[model samples]
Target chain A: MILPSAIALGREFAGARFQIAPVRGLSVQDGLVIGSVLVLIACYLLPLGAVVALSFLVPVPGIGNYWSIFQNATVHAVVGKTLWISSLTVGLTLLLGYITAYALVQAGPVARKLMLAGVLLPLWISVLVRNYAWIALLSPGGIVNSILIRWGWLDQPVSLVRNSFGVVLGMVHYMLPYAILPIYAQMARIDSTLPHLARSLGASPRQAFIRVFLPLSRPGLAAAAFLTSIMSLGFYLTPAMLGGGKTVMVAEFISIQVTETLRWDIATTLSTLLLLVTGALVWRFSHLLELATAKPKT
Target chain B: MSDFTYDTGYMQHLEQSVRRETQGKTVHRRRFLQVLSALGVSIGSLSFLPSARAQQSELVVANWGGDALPAQRDILAAEFVKRYPQIHVAFDTTGPTPGKIKALVESDNVSWDVADRNLLSALELGRQGLLEKVDESIVDINAVPSQFRTEWGVGSYFFSFVITYDAVRFGSTPPRTWKDFWDLQTFKGKRALRNNVEGVLESALLADGVAPDKLYPLNVNRGLDKVRQIKAETIFYSNTSEAQQLLRSGEVSIGSLWSTRAQGVKEDTKGRIDYHFNEGILLIAAWNVLKGAKNVKDAWRWVALSQDPYLQVALLKKLGWGPINPAANKLVPAELQAQNPGSPENIARQIVVDAEWYARNYFEVQNRYLDVLAA
Candidate 1:
């Protein structure tokens, strides 16, 4: 019995040594990749954890923060506006992005490259700079107004900024690039022969597009809309800049609560609600995605 | 216009979080150097890093960026370092907000040692026990006015929301008072007001014939009604930079703006733009040390150095901020004193904002103001 126990101990030590030896043999690149992943986890997950924990803990524990969402009139109005604006942004982005992506897929190589550059150019510039540029162009004395007035369109410059119209215009411009890339990626993957096959089967061009092309692009459309809507919900800068101080949104209001009012209760409550709404949206889209991709019953 | 400024308490928490991330990188670099030294590496470049770091203690000072930061660096931080060669000062040019200060203190990982914050922010945070008690042993507060000094902070500077106008457009006569600012028949042009409810409420009340001394416990309805009369023509600005840009471009003939910004624009435009402190709403800015700051002792010393009258005068000359130390005003030359908001001549004409009243009723007032604006 003693001999058997000694043997078991030796086996355990050997197993631990084997694990240690393999770790020592790890290449520099392998170590670096692992290190990078750990850094990402520490940087991203830790703050996310704090925000999540705070959402429940603030203004007294037990979902009191979440409860305030239904109680406050200002919060209610802001959330309604946020949903309306985000939906409108998603629709506009999808329509414009689909047209642009389709054009890119059908264009010649040189034209495609140029168009791609145009789509990607704004991504390179900082959002703050781009928003400022939009402000300069859209303000009453801005270039657009100057040209319109010069061409005798109106006797005076009209108010084009500091309102809902300006907010939507700025948001749509910022979201277009995000919307374009996914649809374009999916469009590039389509088989060129499918549409041709539909056409050869006695279908008209429009019918070929509707029957074959559009169905294939549904995933891309959904993805683009999902991405744009989620992004639009968190937008703070564009609306704040273009809408002036008059047009308030959820994110901006959350920020104001945290900074000006020092009301962590309200800020956390709004944030938790926003998180839930975003999560619900993503879940709904993924559910639709699963249904679409599910194999037919044999 | 910028998103955040000294007076605007927004986005400071984001800036502080970003600063904390960068501080992590500096720590890593120090650790890397330590490891190199342990390996017996004798590079001369590496030697300087440890030696320089070991000799001097670092203190982080927070202030508003854009013009105020560089002036503070030159007049205050640089001067402090010069006086105490053993100390090194770094300016974190993210404007202060009470929320960020509380976050730093509660986390017990304070990155900023000295914060340039407004009076109400300091009061609110101090009341919450988030700031270090002012080290009276190392610093003196007697020179600062009683209204501006608290147990946790001493006033750094003063500013006012002064009426500014385009000189070319209103060459003969500019809008001199809140009443003139409200009168559209005479000015006959678009005007700009801060997007803030605090200044707007005060100005409206003042314009509607509410005495400055009697403006406390504000009449919400009367102020709102006054604001509504001219709401159609007034463009609201979110920051000083935007307000300056609008005025500089002659887009708005008359506007209410911070004194420092108006002065800067006046100089930049060669006096095509101008403002006066008559009927200005005075605000006091303070510098407080964080509760858990690593360099509290040095931070107190640095704050003390800023109280020097000569340095304060130099600050007033460079930036249009009024010196909080009364001695600084005496040191300021007569010519520049005309522009100094702290000078007795100017202070008498301006009404000091009731900090205590604001600390209690700010949120209620802010929400009501937002409701008014939205309507």
Candidate 2:
């Protein structure tokens, strides 16, 4: 209605045969937009190009580096550790984030706003600060261990820092907010009436949640999982700080090669591998990204 | 910029350690002469020979940039410029050189004239033909110590991995050896060990009572099992900075730590931590000149200047490291000198890590260790 009214008003004011030509507008405006996009493309292309070039040059290629990655039990072990931590963090973040987002929508508006702010507080803090906070919070004399020991749950302070479990906990906590925000945005657009209707049709609330809302939230869940997993995959500092050099992640392993061990080909090759894996995940979920940004229900 | 008055103070400063290593070489030669004399060998049979390779002045040396050694290089460069004004000295410091050497050598992109490499790094570079044949013209023939006179290596600095315990907590009855460290039941609280396999392995082997000379061809299985035994109790630190932080917070009661790192903590803690060298991990920092060197003469000059005892002592005191120069001993305070890696008591007590054996098994053992940790 608004478009037709505006078109008629435009014809009266300008010319009798005015037409809204989006194609013309897009093409003309594309000069600036396309140019900006090309500039951004160059920015991304430069790093990717260097990485592609490096993997081939170092170790004389012919899949020697990749073969080493496969054959070398140590490198594979580190990569495996990285995969384990990243996948676990991603899974837990998605489940917890979706539940929290759903709960936020169900809560009172004022309470929802406060809780959402609390959820986001971790996200806004620097990753390093969060890592240090984890150190203090989870260390033997730190708050958590102190409480646990006081409650007779643990006889002595367990070795928490520099272990895989602490590393995953810290990573999941850091990635939680990133997961929650996207899921919340998706769930916020989900109309409450649909779930109410499901409950009215003899389905219990859990059934209504699982059958009605969960299916609708799948796209967001995919996107949140994708983002969280990718972020966790390259986590060097968290694992280094919390893993205590015991649970070496791929990023940390690669860094040790470059900085301490001085194995550039292996480091660069591993980084290239990390890039490929991350790209594969993004490509696999490209459709979910589309769904995530799809037009909100009319 | 070309004519600035450079400070050769660090290079010109080593007197203590340079003298010590030189004395050992001197003693070896003298003992050899004494043996020859005891056999009634005639000195008249030998004729004095002319030294032909005395004219080279310029050399290039490279190492990991911004560590304790570069300051010595700077001083050495200045000293070399003053001594051999005709010989131009250029130095480059880079990060660890395993991949760099491999890539640089294979591609014929070799830039380093001389490399101050870790033991393993040197072995790898030398194996790849990246290291140059070390000519001993500049080195004092009779004064060159054990590894310095090697076919492929020059002795640089010697440092230690000492057992530093919380002095405030264990003032009198501090843990002395690897056995004491392994006994966590007595040590009390948590224990920290180097996450790097070297110290962990060394401690295990030492506790096993393997002779220092035979530690090479390491018993890796034994080391890993020893590691596994303490895996639950040991807080392994890979990040160098974390060791000191762990000590400060009392998270670790005792730890096997780099001497310099342990000393760094003592500065803040006001000697709250005690470093004992009874079962120290002694290491030699070596300078290996690449075979395809850009500046061979400069590398030699850097090595010669590094051999200066004044510079050795100055760098060690300033950096909490040990010097190759025997003369460095005089510069260190008599009390602190007792703890220095170059000191007689400390040197005799510690075992020199065998680089050759480590070079052979590093790749395999590291993988195995990683698997064990993961498992």
Worst 10 residues of 2 chain B by lDDT: B46-55
- Show where candidate 2 strays beyond 4 Å: A1-72, A107-116, A146-155, A257-273, B1-97, B100-116, B133-142, B148-152, B288-296, B327-333
lDDT tens digits, residue span B85-179, model 1: 88778777766666666666664456788888777767778887878888999889897878898788888788888988888888788888999
Q: What's model 2's interface RMSD, roughly to a tenth of an angstrom?
A: 17.3
Question: How big is the positional error of residue A247 in model 2, measured in Å on the Cα after superposition?
Answer: 1.4
Clashing pairs in 1: B1-B242
Residue A180, model 1: lDDT of 88
B185 Cα displacement, candidate 2 (Å): 1.2
> What tens digits encode model 1's per-residue C-alpha lDDT throughout A47-122?
4444655666655667877766687777777777778888888888899999999999999999999999999998
